[model samples]
Target: MSAVIESHGHDDHHHGPAKGLTRWLYTTNHKDIGSLYLWFSFAMFLIGGVMALVIRAELFQPGMQIVEPEFYNQMLTLHGLIMVFGAVMPAFVGLANWLIPMMVGAPDMALPRMNNLSFWILPFAFFILLSSLFMEGGAPNFGWTFYAPLSTTYAPPSVTFFIFSVHIMGASSIMGSINVIVTIMNMRAPGMTLMKMPLFVWSWLITAYLLIAVMPVLAGAVTMMLMDIHFGTSFFNAAGGGDPVLFQHIFWFFGHPEVYIMILPAFGIASHIIETFSRKQLFGYSSMVWAMASIAILSFVVWAHHMFTVGLPLAAELFFMWATMLIAVPTGVKVFNWVTTMFKGSITYETPMLFAIAFVVLFTIGGFSGLMLAITPADFQYHDTYFVVAHFHYVLVPGSVFSIMAAVYYWIPKWTGNMYDERLGKLHFWLSFTGVNITFFPQHFIGLAGMPRRYPDYALQFADWNAISSVGAFLFGASQILFLFIVLKTVMGGKKATPQVWEGSRGLEWTVDSPAPYHTFTTPPKVSL
Candidate 1:
């Protein structure tokens, strides 16, 4: 009888999640942690969007209408930092936490407790960062890049807080990357060979490697700044015999890979979504894997492209220019594979597919503009201009951000055991698509007309396009609220979803019950291939 009672208690432990707040606080379950990460990232996205709206509002009429120049600088700096580190990167990590285990048929992340720690630390890091706004000297104003002397010598007292916060963020990312690598390497079920794994898993494996390689470099850069600022070192100070340009080299070495780290997972996501809606096998599967590997490898060699105007020798300039352009080859290969997958197929334009299609078209346009900037001579003119701003925003907004939206729409049903409202999902996609193009397309023209970025006021000649751009920015910002609503409503309740959520869906993740049981794969499922 005692043995029987013990067995009953053991069964209770695996039945479902615990009640209320403790479930979130002490849980090691991947799905719960994933939900936490996603919700936190969305909150950050909204906050960052508010900061962006403030900037656009100030830039609306080009006369510093809403904020002081100093405050404007603060908003710009925080906006970039929050959106990249807080919004985009965290969102990708959240997706990884949710999807990677199921894709590989693993019971849970290899380091589940570490996953919990990695996620929980992020809020504190950003809190230290955001709290700086209320301090005496105000928040950081050296721009998100935080080039040396500006960040060290002329920065607000809060720069140290920024450094500390950055360190915490890096630590969180490194821990998360390590978890992904270990889980992928050690936890796959029988017969799931590397090549046979889904593209999303493959994308994340490469991304985890990239994060491990560069996040430390970012931490090291900030550490040097800490020593330079508080300890009187000359890492980036010309007065103390340190070279400022060296700072850019270190930062971009980390920065360029960081860019791929943000988007590689998106490549994985787009492949799955496009294949599902196309009702066809993803074309060039092996080629897609190789293309992603090539992009990750090449990311290391092209860091100097962002510094073309920084007075490097012609030999260095030529090398960096050609290398930057070379990245387009593999990137183009991926694009070709995605497009070819849709050829001669029964395609459906669901919300996920629409976002995937937009990602292909818009990301290519961003890629073309990037090629334009890759010309060393052309970059000299475009450097620090709104053209550069347009180039990256196009890549990030429509490229990385859109792929994330696709994944959310594609998978939320599986997550909640309920299908989202189709009309509302489609509505959200079109509003976002229209708003994204409208907000960013005008910046390309105004940037070409010589409007510099990071300024509070501009010449009247630049007024009209800026006004149009600002209006588009607000439209884009407001539409995100609708997205938030849709996600929340779907989570609460909707039409019941089946185990296989979509008609063409194919993965271990889809084989489970909708809303997935609290503990999945307690006994590893067999993989046929």
Candidate 2:
């Protein structure tokens, strides 16, 4: 493929970014908004990481050492909320803003001002959420799921704030999804057909649609919660003709797709990184796209799997169990494609590739664990156990978070025109890899040993594995500081990079200069097959 740039002189009139805070405060530039999102996500990751460390510290032994059980629950709740809404999701949105326009050969996001609004509102939402910790009765403690009666009747005064913050976040996500959909649907350069677009672009397009479909469901769920809390309704109150299980129904309806929403982009990122480092065109491109679509479609039907232990009917349990297991077919196809792409290729173990490979392996481990939990009989045992916790943390930490790291390493050169410290980059990867495995892998054993999740204290038999997990957690948390330092060091100064920073890189984004211009594809570039 070749791209012919059709430049216009006027497009170069204001080719540099503004010099002050206003550039970020009021600018509609996609790159600026992308940077804002990335920086904000990093900040949230750190805050959430601290909360995680605190949880781990208290659980470092059999007894609560640093925090009371109430505070521990709050930490657990806030950590999940911040990491999901504030860290992983925002980070992907940031990547979408940065890469999608460039990959699709568009000038910028379709709704630039809306993109700005989408990102700016995020910090305020989190501020409201974090402020709840200082409120009377403390922060939300009903777990991140915030199940019915707990979120409504027994919840602290801060639950109202949490609901309000969720509204803000939902609004932001909806707007961001709209921007992504419009940009991709309307802005691809000439001849850059749907299949011709990069896999990353395809992933975001699917994700945006999923967001539009489910974000409203989430909004409705939370709205119902608000009404129940304030207006004396019983939407989820069994005491007032509402079934508490109804909350699980509504929440999981949003929650399960929300899981795919987080992982789908990781799939895309892995595809690109794996292909690039393998020095080969991705194997099974069409199959990969269809597989992702299949997975997305299957996500809606699998929600009940999470509720199997809620005393669902036998038929309902079997239906959900089978539906959940069906997801593995497409997911397995993705894993196969990645591995096949790497087979017989001149693969290099770059920092990005290392992370991507880890994503494939570790995410598959998470996937198999998911299959275990999909067995209705097995789910009965695993539900709410540390095993469940182990499964998701594997999926999320190594699965989503590691993919994000891969993307940053793969594209930071294009964004900054400087090569990062390769030595430190690899060091970060190894430490993170070692730390994450040491942290979560042990939980599988302990969880099977009957340790429950969300508890500040555990029985003596669970102590050894919990201690190992906590130590690994601290190691994993500390390694991120090294990641931050490496990124900052690269941004400050490093070896200059060429347009095609990686020898095997392929995409419209790579066709631009290293440190892509303030405005790119100002006049649509014609793509050739």
Q: How many backbone clashes does candidate 1 have?
A: 0
Q: Poorest 10 consecutive residues of model 1 by lDDT?
A: 3-12
Q: Over the stretch 415-464, how does candidate 2's per-residue lDDT look in tens digits?
A: 99999999999999999999999999999999998999999999999888
Q: Which pairs in model 1 have colliding backbones?
A: none
Measured on C-alpha atoms, candidate 1 has an lDDT of: 0.93
**Alpha-carbon runs more than 4 Å astray in model 1:** 1-13
TM-score of each: 0.98, 0.98
For each candidate, what is the lDDT? 0.93, 0.93
Question: How well does candidate 2 match the true structure in TM-score terms?
Answer: 0.98
Off by over 4 Å in 2: 1-12
Span of 10 residues, lowest total lDDT, candidate 2: 1-10
Cα lDDT for residue 412, candidate 1: 95
Tell me the alpha-carbon RMSD of every candidate.
Answer: 2.9, 3.3
